[model samples]
Every structure is written in C-alpha cells, then in structure tokens.
Target: MAPGYALALAFSVALLVTTDAGNPGLVARITQKGLDYARQQGIIVLKQKLSTLHLPDYSGSYDVGVLGNVDYDINSMVVTDLQLPSSEVTLLPNVGLKLTVSGAYIEIHGKWRVHYLFISSHGDFELKVLGISISVGLSLGSDGSGRPTISTADCSAHISDMQVHFSGGLDWLINLFDDTIASSLRDNLQKQICPLVADAIQNQLEPVLRTLPVTSNIDDVAAIDYSLTGPPIVTAENLDVQLKGEFFERSHRSPPPFSPLPLSIPDDHSLMVYFAVSEYLFNTAGFVYQSAGKLIFNVTDDMIPKDFPVRLNTSSFGKMIPQISKMYPDMLMKLKISSPSAPSLAMKPGNVTISPLLDIQAYAILPNSSLAPLFLLNLSTDAVAKLGVNSSRIVGHLELSSITIALERSDVGPFPVQILSFAVNYYISHILLPEVNDILKNGYPLPLLDHIQLSNLMLKLNEHYLLLGADVQYE
Candidate 1:
C-alpha cells in the first residue's frame, strides 16, 4: 500500500530487481521496446497526475515605496489545460528507468484579490505555464513477500516561462505592481512541480502496482503460485524476473519434494516480452494431484464402449488366461488404475514429453458385494504434449507415444501378461488419455496481470525450459 513498484510492474507483471540467480522455475524478460510502449502509456498517466497538482493560495504584503502597502491573495486556482507533447523512457544499465518529459504546457485560472491603500479590487486572472520539463528516475525491487517494489531514485523539474494576466478590476492600479505579483506566483508554482510528480509516483502509481496479483487461482482444485523467488535481474537491454512457478492443491498447500532444475531462455529481443517456463511447474501439479489422490481412476465395464466385443468379465479374459475362468467361473472385474509416483515432464528442443508409472490393480466382484484382489500390473508410458496459448492461458493435450507393461504380482497364478496388453492399452488410450485431455482443456493461467492479454505469440522449446514470446495489451 505504501510507495512501491512503478509502471514497469504493471507493464505485464514482468518486472524484477537484485538477487542470486538460482534455477528459476519461471522467468520474465521485458525488452527495451517493451519499455518504449510503456513510456507512451506512462505519459498519459503523468499528465493526469499533473493536472491534479494543488498549489497553495499565495498571499503576501509588500511595500512598493510609492505604492505604500500592497496586499494580494490568489485563490480558486485550478488547472484548465495540460499537455505533454514529448516524453522518453530510457533503461539505465544495472540501475532502473529514467523518464524525461519536455515541451510540456499548463494553464491555470484563478481569482485575484488586491488591496492597495484601502482600495480593494477583485478580478479573475489566468496563468500560463510554458516550456516545462521534468526528469524522474525509478528503481525496481522486491518486498519481503517477494512482490515487486518500486521507489523514486531521483527527480527534477524546470519551468522556463510563466505569464499572469489580470482583468475586470482596477487595471491601472494592479498593473503598477503586476511584475512583483507575477514573480511571487511563478516562484510558488515552480517549487511544487517536482514534488508533485514524486508524490504521484509514491502515493498514486505505487499503490496500483502493488495490487498486481502475484498468485492466481487456476481452478477449484488447484492454484498456482507465481511469487518472485528473488529480486529481478537488470541488464542493459532487458529487465528479468524470476518466480517460483509451482502449483498446489486448493485444500493442501505444500512445497513439492523435487526442486527445479536450471532454466535458461534465449535472449531474443524481437518480441516485447518473453516468459521462460521450466518443467518444475508441471511436475508440481503432478505432485499435488498425486498427493491428493486425484490421479487414480476406476475403470469398469460401464467405462468401456458398450458395443465392444469383450466385457470386463473373467469369462472374456478367460479366452487368454484359462486360470481365471477355472477359479472364478464368471465374474465382473474392475481395474483400479493410479500413478505410483508423481509424473515428471521433460522439455526438449521442439518437444515436451512426460513419463508416468501407473499401477493397475485387477479385482473381481463377489456376490457379497466386495472386491477380491486378482492381479497387479505396472504400466510405464511416454506421452507427448502439444501446448498452445489461449488468450492468457496455456492449454495442452497429450498423445501416448509408447507403453510397456510388466507383471508385478499375480494372485491367480502365473500367466502370460502380454495377453492382457491389448485390453490395458485400450483403457489408457480411450479412457485415461481422454480424461487427462479434458482437464488440460481448461488450461492453466499464465503468470500475467489479470487485465493483460497476450497475442502474436511464438513458442520455442529448449532443454528443461520453454520460452513464450508475445505482444501484450493492457486492458
């Protein structure tokens, strides 16, 4: 709520500061061109802030020798028009940002009251401020909670011209000391410009930046944490930020057992902004779901196609494994399939893949309405993921590439495990993959400000990381 990060913080939620560059699960880069775009938007806000500048009513009593004692007060002062025709934002190497506004203009209308030798006259006056210029330096950092923080490094302002006009009063008497009155007015207005700019940055823009969401809800079951892992990295051409891109269950929020590997993205400046995402993010989702027991699926006859030639009964499986029919005669079987451990995702050049170790337990339904253990098979499979950007989310689908099945244990005597491979593969292909795809269809929200939208996206996959470059629009 206090003075914090500046315009860059709102640019795309992609701003940073100084900290040890460990392996970051997520990294955001803002190119110089991005800063250029932000500068244009910043000028509009700057003008609005300046238009609200309040100057204390000026009152003074002076003796002009021949004029005796002259008392004057300027009140009801209000800014009528303000213009910032030109401004520039420059990134300071290893420092922060420098913004300069030149050729600016302002006009103020006020009422003037003058008392000269017991003769009181009141009238309206206009003050025109011209050739105004301002310079501000802003530095970005992180707060104790890893949210970005911005503060004013330095500021300066200069006013080259000020003209005051008086009307509808004793013009002859007022003109006698017009120069003196204008000098005092100019001094009062000039001294407040830089301070007002600083106040706007500290009291106004800073609060808005602090409101930038550091974490967002993905769905009812899971939430993602995009909290800064450390301060940002400042380069001559880019401002880089690192984040802990991990997901946790909605009810149980805890860190995953695995740590992120070193992540690096190409320094391509063609795009305005870039995001580097590591596999740690997806792995954390796997960990959360696995821990919450959401990764398990129960496959029964109803889950299979009704028109399929074979059912989930022992009579159908007996054609291959005769021992099953001899022992249970005819009984419906169910497969309780689940992952043995958290699945891990691997990113490579032009590809992303995940390998899951699933445990499938076979059971037979008895007349007593209870499950009887039959066999347990371990399934290992590789799946390729196709990822795309939808609005501000990352959506993906998985395709099974290869699978291998091995018999871990059997309660109904030893039989060729390969005999059931066709059936098991069918369940994974038709049943498991479809369910996984449905979840992915909802997609995951990217680590961006809620109001920011991305377009013209280009994706590049590298070892251990994927870089997403896109142009952003701030709503």
Candidate 2:
C-alpha cells in the first residue's frame, strides 16, 4: 500500500477511536485486516536459499593390483531427493545463519566404463545412499564495495547406508574391486563434498543478493535512497532487513531527519517501516512555496455578471469611493495572496492540518500608473486536507474548514482584521486551499522491488516519526 493511503487509513481509524468510545475491538480489527492482507500477499512465506542440489558426474582412474591401473568413469550422477527439518534453520541476530538438513536419501543409477591394460569393459551401476545429512554454518559480512557477503564457517556431511552394484564386467574382477572402490570413493566424497557445496553457495548466491536495488525512483519528481543499514537477519521462518536513507530532488535537498527511537518488531505484521520526518522536510517545503510567490486573480467592472457573488457596493466605502471610481477611466483590482511561511503540519484523529502564515496584499491600478498596493494584511490560516493516492501519485483533498486570524501581532494592534475572516475563508476554500492541495498531490511514492510491493499498509504518526506496517506481495 502507498504511504498516502496508509496515512488516510490511519486517520480513519483514529476517528473511530476518538468518536466511538475508544473501542479496542475496532482497532484490533484494523490491525488484523492488515495482517490478513500481508498473508494474502505471501509476505509471511519463508524463502529458502538452497532448494535443490545436483552433481552431474564424477570420474577418476584407480590402481588395481591385478588389473594394473584401471581407469573408471561414473556418468549421470544425480541427487533429486532432499529434506529439511522445521527446526534446522536458526538465526543469530546481527550475525549469520546456521542450517542443517537431515533424513536425505540419494538413489543413484549411472553407467560406468573401465579400461584395463589391454582390455576395455563397460557396465551399468546402481547405488542407493540412505540417511544422508549435512550441517552448515555461514558468516555474514560485507565486500569491499559495502555489499552483503556470505562465507562458510563450518560444514559437515554424513552418510549411513551405502549400496553398490555392477553388471557386465567379469564377476571375479568386479567382486574383487567393488569393496575397495566403494570404500575409497566414500572416504574421498565425505571429505571433499561439503567444502565444494559451501563454495558454490557463496560464489553464486552472494552476488545476486548484493545486487538487489535499494533505491526507488518516481519519474522526474524525486528519488528515495533506501540503502541497507546492515546485513539481513535470517531465521527459521523469515528474513528481516532494515533501511535508513533520505529523499532527493533537483530543486529541494535537505538533511535527513534525526533518528528516532528503535522500532520494536511486531509478530502480527510481516513487514514494518519507520520514517523520521525531520525539520528539513518541512523547511524545504516551505522554501519551495515561498519561492513560488503569490497567486493573483484580477477583477474588472465589466467581468461581473448577473449571478456573480461580488457586487459593486461602493455604498459601504461611502460617497468618496464612488466619486474616485468615476474619475478613473478603467478600474482594475487584483487580490494577491501568498503564504509567507512554509506550512507546519500536524496530525489529529482522521485529519492533517497545515497552518501557514498568510500574507494577503490587495492591489489597484490607477490610470497611466503601475499597479499599487491598496492594502496589506498578515494572518494565519489552518487548512485541513485528507490524503489519498491517484494514478500512483499521492494526493490531497481539501475539506470545507474554518480559518482563524491571528490578531496578536504588534503591527496590527487595535486593527479590526478579524472583520475580514469571511473573505479570508472564502479565498482559502476556493483558491489557497486548492493550491496547497496541488502542492501535496504528488506525495512520496512507495518503494518497490521488481514485481513485489507492500500490501495492506497503514501509517502511524508519532511525535517524531511515522511508522508503517504492511506485507510483501509479488505480481
């Protein structure tokens, strides 16, 4: 789920809790719903690193007393059956992994060729090895480039049942060499196979894991850096990983927020993300808004229609205003508005409030003169909006809300700016509010990994951080 949607969902839940007598059951239901979604997405399923093992062929030449340096080759050597006990996988927190596979069996059937001093013979061979098991310990580290790396600390293999058979070769010679060949092969395999398997896993699997992308892009808007903070933790049922990074944009760059308190792993959720919303994010947003300046709408006498809410009520400003208006050939007025301060955001039950110090300046154009400021007013307004997602972009919808004007400013002492409350509210509802929403319509996009995405996500707002919970899903 996207963070925008999560924030909205969390707000809804908060509303229920606050308005519905704080029912614990409803909160539990919401959490359970998130968990169910996670399960459906397959985030709860544990993935195994090594699922199958295959050995193609093993061939060598051996010295036989009477046969005088016999050469033998075993073709099509394969093992397809393997098992892993539920308790065999263990995790060492901030460390590595220990895995054990037991009760494995290999039914081997292959062709063998043997060459004597002057004679060559070929035959079929059948062998069954039962009660096979292996135990391996892996250590996690990092390569020179800071990518994850895995190395084998210890490995051992055991074989209990060994049966061998041969056909077509002379019975006497075969019988004489069968026991010796089997014994020598078993000893050599027992000593060498474990290290070879370990090497293959480290060399082949490590690079794939390390190359996994940790950064996410959102077209031309922004890029989120999600580099891993440390190596992943592997346990019996799942793997846990953590990321700590920041967002980057061409026009806006700010230092990351300070780290919040450590997160507690929750058993009910398969995945969790913690975001610390720093002062930098808010300050950067403010800078962007200030740089854009004010929005203006022009009004003309002829533009007013019959249904227009605005009337030419010069009677309120008295006879002098009407006389002054008559002297100007063309009368024009502009309502210029700007938010001088970047909006400060706060969260409540089912709502997010953005309060920005607004600077409203009205202008009038006199004949043959440049636009002049008619009036200047400074006040603060709270714009409430709801979060959502649209076409992969996080958006906000403004709500019909009231605005409060700040009258404590020293410069506006004794002035009746409060009388303009209705006009300010109207302007915000129709214009300023939409502008703020437009700025927020492109909220951060969710991070993704190829075909996988986070499912049924929810966000929780804390004093200093934003907590996200969800499950993984593969397309």
User: Which regions of candidate 1 fall more than 4 Å away from where they truly are?
Assistant: 1-21, 62-65, 118-120, 217-222, 248-258, 291-294
The residue-by-residue lDDT of candidate 2 on 16-122, one tens digit each, is 11111111111111133332343333211211222233434666666667657776776765443333332254555456666565665555566777776777777
Whole-model lDDT, candidate 1? 0.76
In Å, residue 169's CA in model 1 sits off its true spot by 2.9
lDDT for each residue of candidate 1 in 1-475, tens digit (9 for 90 to 100): 1111111011111111112245777888888877787777767778888888787787888777776878888789899999999888887877778899999989989888889876999899888888989889998878776677777898888888888788878766666777787777667777887787787778866776676557777546566677787666787778887887777778977777878788666778888889988877767777776787666667788778987766888898888888887788789888887778877777788888777788999988887869988899999898787877765877777788988999999999998899888888888887666766665656667777646788889887788777889887778
Off by over 4 Å in 2: 1-71, 76-89, 104-109, 115-120, 126-223, 228-242, 248-337, 347-352, 364-371, 383-400, 406-423, 432-443
The deviation in Å at residue 30 for candidate 2 is 20
Backbone clash total, candidate 1: 4
Residue 154, model 1: lDDT of 89
Q: What would the TM-scores of all predictions be?
A: 0.88, 0.61
Q: Clashing residue pairs, candidate 1?
A: 4-150, 5-150, 16-232, 17-232
Deviation in angstroms for 240 in model 1? 0.7
